[model samples]
Target: MAIYRKLEKEDKEKLVGIFQQPSAMYDYREFDEDALIADENCNCIVIENDGEIAGFASFITYRVPTKGLVGRIEDVIVDEKYRGQGLGRGVMEKIIEIAKEKKVSLIDLTSNPKRAAARKLYESLGFEIHDTGVFRLKIK
Candidate 1:
């Protein structure tokens, strides 16, 4: 059985493991314990199975310029061994609840076009692809 819950400090290593997976696009290569602890708007949730971390989701709520308030799903991933077990959905549901509680007016996320299953899951969760383009350039 899997359980979705708030990430505790002791669980930092486990949370990092999810981000460290080769397939994970979370960009946690620079993630540190202080980052999670110091950001009040950041919420890290994890899905654990029988004491092992299997999936994770990270969310951030903030007011964007011209966008009042919003909750952004920074990342979501379920370990390959646990993908079909509803763990992804479960973690997303938990994150949604957290967003609601935080009173975010909107929730946003971007997924790779190749991740059809993930896109479907986001759609089922009421997320839609906005008609806006997302771009990025690494400063380093």
Candidate 2:
């Protein structure tokens, strides 16, 4: 059975392994477990299969004047060895449950066009592509 729950300090190493997979597109950052666990606005989930970490995901919730509380999911990934076992869906479902509990008015996520499977999963969970442009500026 898979266990889905909030990220724990001991999970950092295994979570890092998942992000290091070639399929993970984002620029890797050193995880500050203390900050992550202490942040009131961040909700993170880790999936454990037979006592080993199988996947990880997280979302940040904040209040917007117009939208009220909104959530943006980030860094969702399943270990390469565990793909196709519904662990991704399991983690995402857990995030959605947290969002609902927080009364999030909207939730958003971004995926590279190459991530067809991830896109399909999001759609299956009722996420729609909004007609908006995403822009980023990297500042050191």
Candidate 3:
């Protein structure tokens, strides 16, 4: 079983373990905890299994003139050992609860097309494919 809670600096190593999985889509060698928490809108959460990190999820809510309030979910990942156990859904449920409290008009996230399981999970959670052009320029 996994218990979900707000992320903390002490979770750094355990979180690294979870992120080591391929589905995470990023080679995150380290986490900038101070920088993240410095942002008042950051909501990072972790799932723990027997004192070890089993999953991660995060979201940020903000308002704009055109869109009102919206929440963007970020970097949701579960350790390979914890997959198919509903841990991902559990983490997303927590995000939704918080997003509701924040009164967000929408909650959004992006998943790699190769991640079929993840896409199915998101769909089961009531998330639909929103047609939009997601572009990025690697400035570095």
Say which candidate scores most in TM-score.
2
lDDT per prediction?
A: 0.75, 0.81, 0.77
State the displacement of the C-alpha of residue 63, model 2, in Å, after optimal TM-score superposition. 0.8
Q: Residue 57 in candidate 2 has what lDDT?
A: 88
Better model by lDDT: candidate 1 vs candidate 3: 3
Residue-pair clashes per prediction, in order, are 0, 0, 0
**Which pairs clash in the backbone of model 1?**
none
- Tens digits of lDDT, candidate 1, 36-116: 877788887878987888977888878878766777786788887787888998998888777777777778788788878
Model 3 Cα lDDT, one tens digit per residue, 22-135: 656466745788777677688988888777788898888788687778788878888888788889899988888888887787777777788788788878877778667221
What is the Cα-based TM-score of model 1?
0.83
lDDT-wise, the better of 1 and 2 is 2
lDDT of 2 by residue, 1-140 (tens): 89898888888877777788888845557588889999989988888988888888888988879877888888888889999999999888888788888888778788878888988898888787866622111111
Give candidate 3's error at residue 50 in angstroms.
3.3
lDDT of 1 at 35: 75
Per-candidate Cα RMSD to the true structure, in Å, reads 5.8, 5.6, 5.8
Predicted structure 1: clash tally: 0
